[model samples]
Target chain A: MMRNLFERTGEKTLGFLQRLGRASIFLFHVLKGFPIVLTRPKLLLDSLYSVGVLSLLIIVFSALFVGMVISLLGYVTLVDFGAEQSLGVLVALSILRELAPVLTALLYSGRAGSALTAEIGLMKATEQLASIEMMAIDPIRRVITPRFVAGIIAVPLLTLMFMVVGIYSGYLIGHGWLGVDEGSFWAQMQSKVQWNYDILNGLLKGFIFGIAVNWIALFEGYDAVPTSEGVARATTRSVVYSALIVLALDFILTSIMFVEV
Target chain B: MTQAYIEIKDLTFARGQRQIFDGINLEIPQGAITAVMGPSGCGKTTLLRHIGGQLQADSGSVSVAGVQMNGLSRSELFALRKQMGMLFQSGALLTDLNVFENVAFPVREHYQFDESMVRDIVLMKLEIVGLRGAAQLMPSELSGGMARRVALARAIVLDPALMMYDEPFTGLDPITLGNIVTLIRSLSKSLGITSILVSHDINESLSIADYLCVLAEGKVVAQGPVEVVKATASPWLKQFLTGSTEGPVDFHYPATSRANDFHLEAKS
Candidate 1:
């Protein structure tokens, strides 16, 4: 039984390594298609419209509620120390440094990423990809790369949007609803939130999460089993895997960027 | 006899444990319609893929138009594929695009023609397939036969030297099937292109085919003209052509005797 356990572990490790290698190769091919995709601007624009524009309402809606809750909770807690004036600092710092980038990525993966997986998976299932190949066109270049570039570009922009809306909503709750001083709220947030440390790093984190999410989504679709059930499973895996990767990357990025040496 | 356009020799392939093709040898003639027929799951589509260079042989050669498929570089293979067209079993039209755009796809990919020229070429192909009026319709709006015709227009848009059809007659009404049969016959004659059709509709294929090839057990068991194949002495070939259950191809699943399977005592 002990030997069997070791053997199983070894086999699982090898299988994981094989998949990792294939995924890396897939990324390479996708990157190589970048030049071709750039020459055709319409493809990129269409992808942006689907993945970025269509996702705007959800991001804004979710960010507003999250920011309000954080502001409300921060106000109640800081009142104990009579330090309720620092509510802006708490709200701005949390939204910029953590919540905006992470939540936007999670939402993007659930919405745009899953749709991408299902679309590509259905294309494969229906032999559209093979037909593209028989037409002497590379499906990777024509289909996958545009969406990949769009996702990467869209995430950082969405994160910035999320940050703006979140901070503003926090202001509405802290000053408008609650009895916080407006001057202290703006003053404390401006003083505490550094552009380089908080905002720039957050955007960078968003960019990295974009790559992870799109990579997983595209690979899952392209490598799917090409059936209705297969596409469904791939869509689920794309969202689930991307959410996990985003959270894990958040922890690692926070440790590196925010942790004082 | 016409010169061979596609030649497969000693082709062998297996998917994990199931060997799909085993030492199969066949030749498709140039500018002629060759029908490849076999029972379901007997690798008719697999043979077409092999010829199209979509699937590589295990230890053999698949040469199309004198170029060995396995030996071409990626760019070289793609260059070759430009002169080849394949209609998938599902019609495989880009669902996102309308009928006009689907037919125009290959032309757009290969060249930078003016909008007018592209429009003219697309309309011409759609006209040939009797779908000119349906150009603005989406794939989802099309019937199965209409979708297949649109896919056929797309396949032939580039005027390829060779065309492959994978089960093109499947899942069609009798009228649509008859229309497809006539369209394929006329297309082959007018285009003067080598055509290989993979289908289970024996009568439809034999109606248009200049040659017939039947595959079973990973080999070509019968191959000749339509009349020759019709008069074949091979029981498996006869069984397949006539759609009879009694033949070497068993109707029952391979298992122990029924009594043994039921756990009954053996009769002495």
Candidate 2:
């Protein structure tokens, strides 16, 4: 029993290391193809149009609702302690710290990440990647690079939009409907919030989340077994795993950022 | 004897626990058509993939056009693949790209040719496949034979030294099959390229194959010139060539007892 346990543990460790190695190689390819992405404006524009502009409404709506709910929750709890005026501060902090980046990433993963994996997976299944390779073209440079660069460029921009819209929606709900004074709401937010730390940390989280989403999508697509069912499975796996990782990384970054302060 | 352009030495491949090809040895001579014919599930497509460098062998060597394929890097193998052409069973054209773009794909991706040069090459290849007027058509718009021809044009666009056709005549009417076979023969000869054809259309393939190989149970049961393969006494080869229902191939079906059970159940 002990021998079997040891063998299983060793196998698990080896598998983990192998996955890590593959991820590093994928990252290396993505980095190497960055220049090609810059040179190809059409590809970049297309990806931006797909990943950013098409995804704007969903991200904005989700963020607004999320912000309103968080503000309501903070207002109810603070009212119990006679601190209802702090709702603006609470909403601003939550939007910047947690809700905005995570919610936007989840929405983006569903729309952009699933599409990326499916498109690439289908290309692979049809041997289009083989054709590309046969033509001495680097698929990473031609196909993967544009998607990765687009994700990196798109996610941060989307997250910023999410934060702005979310915070405004929260303010509208709290001050306009909830009867909080407009003058005090802005005062409370400006006094209580640290812009540098909150904005920088959120942007950092967005960047990492973008990388994680694209990495998972590209890896799943690249390793996609060639079949109709296999491509479907890859698309689902990419979205699920990327969303999970985005949430996990958000928690880690949030704890690290606030714990020191 | 024609010089062996693509050589396989003790090639073997296994998928997980199942051995697909075991110690398979074959040579495709230069400037001639070599047809690999086998029953379904006999690893014919796998052999074509091996030659195209899509699948690697487990324990032996495969060399094409003086390049050792076993130890080459992925990029090196890709470079070698550029010198060869392949016609997939399903045509495998990119559905999103139109016919012109599909034919021009390899050229545009590989070479930095101007638009005029790319257009000229694409039109020329399409013309060779008798698809000059259908350059703007989508794959969905084309028939099976037209798609196959488009695939053929894409395959030969770079003027590859070797061409591998995987089931070129599959799922086609007799007329289309005949035309494709004729095109295969005339194009390979005129282009002076060695071709390896994997097909189940035995009679048609035999009409075109200068050299023929018969695979059964992961091994070469018979191989030689087309006339010699036809004269072989191997019962399996005879059954395959003659399309016999009662022969070595009957073993592929379920046991007689199970077949009898089905009949009895139908009667009851």
Candidate 3:
């Protein structure tokens, strides 16, 4: 039993290493094709519309609800210590530093990331990729690099938008709804939330998460087995892998930025 | 026979354990239609991939227009590919683009042609395939045969010297099938382009092909002019040509015997 277990584990480890090697090569090709994609601006713009603009509604709605809930929780907790005025700091810091970038990435993975996987997977299954190859056009440059650039551009932008909307909704709850002192709330938030320490770090995290999520998504699609079921599985894996990578990268980035090492 | 435009010699390839092609040799004459017919899972499509330089041979070489496909650089292979065109079985049109844009794709990819020139070339190719009127329709809106015609239009848009049709007649209605067969014949003759058609549609292919090759068990079973293919003495070839189930070709995949699998005793 122990031998079988070790054998299976070893095989799995080898498979994973093989996949990692392939993904690294795919990334290299995508980066190499980046300049070629720039010459075709319309491809990038279309990808932005799909990956970023279309995802606006869900991001805004989720941000508002999350912001309100965080404010409510923070107010109730702080009221016990007569520090209810600090509700703004709690909500603003959480949204700007943690919630905005992480939640935006998770949602982006579910929405744009899965869609990208499905689209590219279907393209492969239907032999569109092969057709492009037969035409002597590299599908990586023609198809993948534009979407990668667009995702990197979109995720950070979406994270920033999420932060703004989340903070605004937090203000609405803390001052307008919960009846906290509006002047003290704004003052505390402004004093507490350092631009470089919190906001810039969050955007930096978003940037890294953007690269991770898009890389996972595109690689999954490109490496997918060419079939209907393969595409479906690839789409699922894209979202799941993106979510995991986003969360894991969040922890590492947070430790590096916020922790006193 | 004319000088060979595409040559395959001692080519062998495998996917993991199962060898798909074993020492297969072929010579496709310049500016003639060569139909490669084989059973399902018999590597007809794999042969096309070899000829197109998408898949490399294990033991031998594939040469297209005198250029060895194996060791050429990516740019060189791509440059070679520009002189070749392949119509995939699924039509494989870019779903996002309309038929006009799909047909214009190859031209637009290679050259900075004026819109008028692109449109003129695209429309002219579409007219040949009788899809000029359907240019504005999306791939999703197209019928299977319409999509195939559009793919063919795209394949020929660059005026390639070599054209490959991979199962060009599969999944088409008889009328559509006839149209495609006619198109394949006329295009090869009119443009004087060498053609390699990989298909199982024996009658349709034989109707259009000048030369015929029948592949079985990773080897060419029979190959000659269309006239001689009908009178081959090989029982395997005869059975295949006639579409008979009773032949050397097994109806079932290799597996345990039914009685053994079900644990039934043999009848005395």
Candidate 4:
């Protein structure tokens, strides 16, 4: 019984390590071949149009609601302290420093990341990738690299858009509706939210989240067993794994970027 | 004997606990049509994959032309693959691309040719398969035979020296099956390409094949010229060729007796 337990544990550990090694190699290939995308701008643009442009509705709607919720939450708390005037700083900092990057990444992982995994997984299952290899074209350079570059570009840009729409919507709800002073709201936000400290760090988070999400996506797809069930499982795994890793890394990056600031 | 165009020596392969190929050896003659025919579960498709370098043997040397498949680097293997073409059972055309682009895929990716050159070559190849009119059609729109023909067109568009077809006649109607068999034989003659076909369509295969190989239970049971195979008297080979399940091939599944397993009284 003890020996069997040891064997099972060892097998599980070996499997996990093998997966990690394969994922690392896949990530290295994506980074190494990333420059190839410059010659193939159309692929990246198409992906951006898919991953970024198509997610616009959800991002805008979510940002608006999230911004209003933050305003409401901040307003309730500030009423206790008699500092409702600080709602501008509260909403601005929350959106720029945290919500924009993290929430945008979560949405992108659910939407674009899942689709990328499914598409590539299906291609692998169908032997289209193998056919590409047989034709002397590198599937990594031809397929995944463009998509990876696009994800990196699109995610950050989408975060910026999210931040913009979100902060303004917060302005409407906090000041336009709740009767926080319009002057004090603008004044407090400008005074408190430093560009380098909040905005740049948030964009950086967006960029890193983009890379992590796509890396997980492409890895899951490439590593998926060539079957319908395998592809389906990998698609779900990509979303779940990408979301968890993005959130986890957001904490680490937030500590490194913001804790110091 | 002259060196074969493709050779496999001491090839052994297994999937999990199931042995697919056991120290198998094969030599495909140059510029000939060779058909590998066997019972349904025999490793015919697996053999083609080993030759294609899609699967590696547990212990063997698979040489294509002069290149040893396992010894080749990733890039080298791909370079070797460029000299070969494979038609899968389902056609395996990229669903995203239309039929013309599917045929044009290999040529366009490999060479820096202009669109016109691609169009001409693609049209010419499609014309051979009688699918030129179906160029703009999606793979989803293609009939099974049409899809296979389009795949054949894609396989040949690069004009590779070797072509592998997996069950080209398995699900085809009689007319389409006849058409595909004729196409394979005619194309082999015209292109002078060595062809390895995996199928169980005995009449069709034997009709077109210069050489025939039969695999059973992870080993080559018989292989020779079509006339020699036709003359052979092995019971295993005869039962297979004659499609008689009552012979060596057990009609009963391998299992404990039904009475013992189900705890039932035996029928008188």
Question: Which candidate wins on DockQ?
Answer: 1
lDDT of 4 by residue, B1-268 (tens): 2348988888999999999988788888999999998888889998888888878889988898977888678788888888888888888889988999899888877789998988999999999989889999999999999999999999989889999999899889999988899999988999898999999888888888999888988888887787888798498788888888778779888999898889898669
Q: Which is better, 1 or 2, measured by TM-score?
A: 1
Candidate-wise lDDT, in order: 0.93, 0.87, 0.93, 0.89
Task: Tell me the spans in candidate 1 whose CA falls farther than 4 Å from its real position.
Answer: B262-268
Q: Is the docking of candidate 2 incorrect, acceptable, medium or high quality?
A: acceptable
* C-alpha lDDT of residue A185 in model 2: 79
Taking the candidates in order, what DockQ does each have? 0.91, 0.47, 0.88, 0.61
Question: Which lDDT value does model 2 have at B157?
Answer: 90
Models ranked on DockQ = 1, 3, 4, 2
Candidate 3 versus the native: TM-score?
0.97
Model 3, span B94-181: residue lDDT tens: 9999999999998998999999999999999999999899999999999999999999999999999999999998899999999999
**lDDT for each residue of candidate 4 in A1-261, tens digit (9 for 90 to 100):** 999999999999999999999999888888788776786677788878888899878898999999999988889899799899999999999999899999999999998999999999999998888777666678898888888888889899999999999999988999888999999988999999999989999999999999999888988999999999999999999999988998899899989987856
Q: Which candidate would rank higher by DockQ, 1 or 3?
A: 1
- Best to worst by lDDT, what's the order? 3, 1, 4, 2
Angstrom error of the Cα, residue A116, model 1: value is 0.6
Clash count per candidate: 0, 0, 0, 0
Of candidate 2 chain A, the 10-residue stretch with the lowest lDDT total is A128-137
Give the runs in model 2 whose Cα sits over 4 Å from its true position: A1-24, A76-85, B251-268
Q: In model 3, which residue pairs have backbone atoms overlapping below 3 Å?
A: none
Q: What is the C-alpha RMSD of each candidate to the true structure, in Å?
A: 1.5, 3.4, 1.8, 2.1
Docking class of 1: high
